[model samples]
Target: MRRALNIKNKLSFIDGNISKPTDSFDPLFTPWEYCNDMIIDWIQHSIGFEHRLTIAHADIATNVWTDLRERFSIQNAPRIFQLTKAISSLVQNADSVSVYYNTLKSYWDELEIYEPMPLCTCGSVKTLTDYNHRTKVMQFLMRLLRLYSGSGSSI
Candidate 1:
């Protein structure tokens, strides 16, 4: 959704790109209205009516998205605690190596989605990417079962 909007150059409208118009119809009027309509339609179809009501007054896609994010993606203490507990208790007993890794990756991915790493104003994310990779590597090693104890000591 975001990629498509960006490709259409409509993303700026939602991200606070404003312009002053002297006449009734501004140059950005049509496209901006189009983008907002599309976003509202998407929200209505993807989310139920109850959720749609919360964003009904939002005139721009950004406002609607921000409201949705605040309602759904405000990661708090309890969610963090649950994710940490799940990560700490993960095991690789019955599953194959690939399965175990995939499961762990899913949890890590969810954690990331909820608590995204901070990015600079210039959009640089290298540090966050590297940190996530290192954390995943360490998690994989730490969760190995007792059968790999001898091999683990070599590391």
Candidate 2:
């Protein structure tokens, strides 16, 4: 949504970079209102039917955007737990190397979305990312069949 708004050059409507003009006499008031209504329509069209009412009374694009973000950006504990359990219990079993790897990668990708690494400017983020990569590699190796374990064979 952010990317689409940016592409349309309307991100300012919801990003707080531009504010609605207060004076009716101001020349920018008309154009700003028009753009705001357009953005509101785009947001409403993009969201689900069940969520439309939550922002139906919103008069500003920023308010609508904020309400939607607050409503949907919460961390879901049950989903995170499910993903973790699945990753831990997964094994190569009878699947080919590529199939097993792809399945594991998919799980990992979803888990990352739920539990994303923190960002900072202290340079610790790089170290943490490296550690995470090494950990994932180990987990993948640990789940492989006995024949492939420590065999040094190309995947």
CA lDDT of each candidate?
A: 0.73, 0.90
Q: Weakest 10 consecutive residues, lDDT, candidate 2?
A: 146-155
Tens-digit lDDT track for model 2 on 31-147? 999999999999999999988888887899999998888776688799889988998899999999999999999999988877899989999999999999988888788889998
Q: Which ranges of candidate 2 are over 4 A from the true structure?
A: 85-110, 137-155
Candidate 1, 74-148: lDDT as tens digits: 767787788878888998988887898898888888888788888677656886778778778878878887787
TM-score of 1: 0.61
Q: How high is each candidate's TM-score?
A: 0.61, 0.70
RMSD of each: 5.0, 3.7
The residue-level lDDT of candidate 1 at 59 comes to 66
